[model samples]
Target: MSEDTETVSVHGREFQRTSLDEGVYYAPVAFDDREESRLTAQHEIVSRIFGDGLFSPRIPVGEPEAILECGYGGGDWAVQCADEFEDCEGMRVRRLSSRPMSRQMDRPENLDLVAHNLNDPLRDPEIFKANHYDLIHSRFVFPGIKSGRWNGYIRDMRLLLRPGGWVQIMEYLPIIQSHNGRLTDQNAVRRWWQEYQGAMADMDRDPRIGRRLKRLLLDNRYRDVEVDIVQLHIGDWSKNETQASIGRDSVEMIGDLLESLGLWPFTSKLGWTAARFEDLMQEVRAELQNVELNLYIEL
Candidate 1:
């Protein structure tokens, strides 16, 4: 970590904060052990939602020789993908992240972790050469990337992709809705979401980036762009056992996200007191536990 990026303690939790001029990384959440665990669990939940697949079947490539994952929090996806293609000859899985990764004894040999900021161009041209990657993937990275820089981010990723290479981006819609029309104006979750979206927009981060990804790719001249929507039920409302289990896990994940993702932006950017934010979250959690509400989020 550089002087531009420093850890600050807030509400007894340590969070990484960046100078506005740095433009390397900016997120409300902390990049600590708890966050790492949450990210890994989130990866598993998302993988299960997509049938445990790493990439879409529609992707043209087969057994990609070179893979790149941008904003790979905890490197969970990269590590798993590397393990999946470990036997393939000349296979390489490169992960780009702002956080420094400690050496893992069980790390896959084909996986390479790089500390780089997504907001800026690749620092090392030799390593991140043009047309070098077979596939470029990112998930939930919009929060850290400035709204004005999305075009450059896409262009840079395009530059790194080999001919006919595919880029997969997964993001949350950042709004929670009720499938049964039970969510109302009085709901704390809905209020919180509205304020959160405004705060993010004020910070130049697009809260609805998930819905715009296809347009972004198309505008970037990418072909065969496909968008997949995954519905995440918050509580144990599903009739199916697997879906119910996933819902339970989602409740926990969303709770963690409410605190980690909302704390800084809510208090600092939105002028909310810490106590006010905490009270709002308590109400939001209560609402999330109501299965009859049928709350869900789109990804």
Candidate 2:
């Protein structure tokens, strides 16, 4: 890892420059493979963008021979890309609080995991020089940005990307799922979405960050960029067995994120009392118990 990294603190969570591994993000006590599957799903979206040819898009002379990923929340995508595009360098950002680099670099591979607080503007705001990088990728980065320093997200990407270099921002549209393709209470779901959308608008994080990416690329001076709203169905919710299991697990994941950052102290206006929230969550879980599968975004 590079020694020239910076650190910052916001919303009580500290950000540091460090590399990542499975054990850092995933709890050592958890036995499930959900995180593993989530990483696979993200790569599938990238694969769809790459089409059937070699990983590298035809590039003009003097372009950097590497790709950069802004917030490598999970390192799996970089690992997969390294396996696929052996010649391209895959870049990733690491939290400052993570484990030592010596342990992570023990495995010899082409991928370079760096230690850098990605949102620090003064520290080479533009990661790669102008016209550098064949492609730049970032995903699931907004939740972290809510703490502060939002502009750094766009500015860094714009400054780092080489002219004509492709930049792809794949983000999830925040949505609370319902089993059986029917909202448990249409009013409740609608209310949740309206308020959620309004919050995102205020934060400048587009709800359709995935679909709006084309416009973002254009606005940021990227040429020939395209965005797709890819909706993935995890399971067939109509089948009772599947939906119930997913519903239970999905609610648990949201609870985990909320509690992880100590965020529950701020959401009282939503009418979510401890008991009421559990009841509602259990309702969704029960709804899933009767259904076979479910669909949701990663946000």
Candidate 3:
């Protein structure tokens, strides 16, 4: 189906509204300063968690001749990666709901940015040549891809990769867990997460896509699939200095995410009043600060 895109304002935030039959690009987050900051913090946290690596694939694909990063939020990962692989040509594909194009300036000379809806196929054969890219990286893009279209999405990635090319995808599990059994159904964090998951499911997006990535890749005949899971603490709960630092960042990021990510979904999709959503977020934020609960999220 053809898509007509327009900028939309919701609750003092901006989102890209697209007219599509299948309803791809369902991300509820705004494309404003808060969202950009959140993406930046998330990138730093994930990089530290993974030992500052740009990409993760055990079987080395050697020096990538060309790289493609889908859902290049805030363009942090793409810019850093371009610097790491300075000689390689890189393309950053931003979703329709990403920040303004003007914000993407000052990128590396070898890095090119393109605005595209990932749910649809990359139609520009001349630009997106068949089996041309050596490495394809995507992170936190599952929300923009419909659940039923994962197979088609994987097929498209395969078509874009060279024979030995590697594709790295990183996603976060929607559920929140506790190291101890302190977290219960009555907890505000758990309640908010449940609502968030329901909203995603209602929009035909897979909230559990992180856990399903390995199976999805293997089923698509992608050999040697590797799964890496990192647990992110919600507060300064860890005794280790590095982990405590990460947890502090996580608390701040998650607090911001409570509003940025949940504002639209909870209010729009779940039929919640704006005031009610804000009240719940307050409680969730407070709950996240409790080191005693030992709450954490898996990525």
Q: Judged by lDDT relative to the true structure, which candidate is superior, 2 or 3? A: 3
lDDT of 3: 0.74
The digit string of per-residue lDDT tens for model 2 on 155-271 reads: 566776656666656666656464346654443433445655554455434455555456555665656555455443333443455433443444444433323212222233233
| Candidate 1, residue 69: how far the Cα is off, in Å | 0.5
Q: Candidate 3: deviation at residue 241, Å?
A: 2.9
- TM-scores of the models, in the order given: 0.90, 0.57, 0.89
TM-score of decoy 2: 0.57
After superposing candidate 3, which stretches have Cα over 4 Å from the reference?
1-6, 19-23, 26-31, 57-61, 89-105
Residue pairs with backbone atoms closer than 3 Å in model 3 (clashes): none
Give the TM-score (vs. native) of candidate 1. 0.90
* 10 residues in a row with least lDDT, candidate 1: 21-30
The model with the greater TM-score, 1 or 3, is 1
lDDT string for model 1 (74-120, tens) is 67788888888887776776656555442242568888766567777
Candidate 2, which ten residues in sequence have the lowest lDDT sum? 22-31
Q: Give the whole-model CA lDDT for all candidates, comma-separated.
A: 0.77, 0.44, 0.74
Where is model 1 more than 4 Å wrong at Cα? 1-6, 17-31, 102-106
